[model samples]
Target: MTTHHPTQTTTVQTIFRFLLGGALILAGTSHLTWARTEFLAQVPQWVPLNGDLVVVLSGIVEILLGLSLIFLARQRVLVGWVVATFFVLVFPGNIAQYLNHTDAFGLNSDLARGIRLLFQPVLVAWALWSTGAWAAWRRNK
Candidate 1:
């Protein structure tokens, strides 16, 4: 007989999850406050909605997602999926920033922007790992 236990989260994973949640909250606050103008640079030109509106809305979303990550441990797997999806959804903005050479968040150089673009997938992976979402999905397969 084979016994398979679900993947359990480690202390490191919990810490990272909290850290990521805090980061998202801080970033979202910035989007609505001191860094609002800088965030504008990330809004792709093709997005028909007003850049200000988009930034504001995304800020709100980030805050809500952050809260979920921090407080929704019971639903962490779902929250992880949502957070990872959010990372994927925002990738185009990162790409647009890099391609358009729009400076924001001190990523003034193309290299810097390019590097930031590379981190999106890391964020997605982080969300999945920290919340055990990847483990859960894999276990079900």
Candidate 2:
């Protein structure tokens, strides 16, 4: 009887995942502390919660997701899906920042903010690709 071992993630994918995780951790830390006020620019005014509370909560969630990305290789597919969903869920904030002309993170002009909005999908793709979620999903289908 043969016991099958899951294939290891490639070196490039591992490195990219780590980089993404590190970026998430740093950004999450900024959300809770130094960049709290700056993050407010992304919060839609229509949101019922206090902006600070939203930032803090999201920061905690980011830290958890980032850590999972770094440490949970066996569960990478699920993590990838969750991370992609997270990117989707938070996209409105990016749109709000662009529409409201809020200056944060040095994204002062509408062009800059609009450009920033374009990167969210890239992040979603990164999460899915780096973790092999897209490939796994395709293989299963």
Candidate 3:
């Protein structure tokens, strides 16, 4: 089997990471003001946190994660880890919404909601992989 250089792999992964971060930044911006309330509606009742607090916290985190990926080039490894962790941390909110049948940002759905639940893991994987996190672990071993 042919082998790839570590630098080449790192470059490709960095591009993917930037793209994903940009997308998330945009997604997060969509929820800042009026969108915040709309997004808050999707949070399930089972979540113990106050709805407003959740909205604020989620927005801030999305922005931070996006910014870290874009600006923290030297610390890519840490950024990757943080992004991956954030995804995992927020996943329950998605699941809670799915389970509760709550409207998400007022989006109309037809299996889209369920589709989103599946998509979350894919997103998590993308963030992890694009940040070279899987590769990093291999190296540290």
Best by lDDT: 1
Better of 1 and 2 by TM-score: 1
* Superposed model 1: Cα runs more than 4 Å off: 1-7
Poorest 10 consecutive residues by lDDT, candidate 1: 2-11
Candidate 3 lDDT, 1-141, residue by residue in tens: 976543224677788988988987886786676588777866667778888888777887898889888888767777778888887887877777777777765444637677877877788788778876667777668
Q: Which candidate number would show the highest TM-score if scored against the true structure?
A: 1
Residue 30 accuracy (lDDT) in model 3 = 64
- Candidate 1 per-residue lDDT, tens place, 11-119, comes to 8998999999999999999999999999999999999999999999999999999999999988888999999999999899999999999988999999999989889
TM-score of 3: 0.83
TM-score of each: 0.94, 0.93, 0.83
All candidates' lDDT scores?
0.93, 0.89, 0.76
Candidate 3 wrongly placed segments (more than 4 Å): 1-9, 105-110
Worst 10 residues of 3 by lDDT: 2-11
The residue pairs in collision within model 3 are none
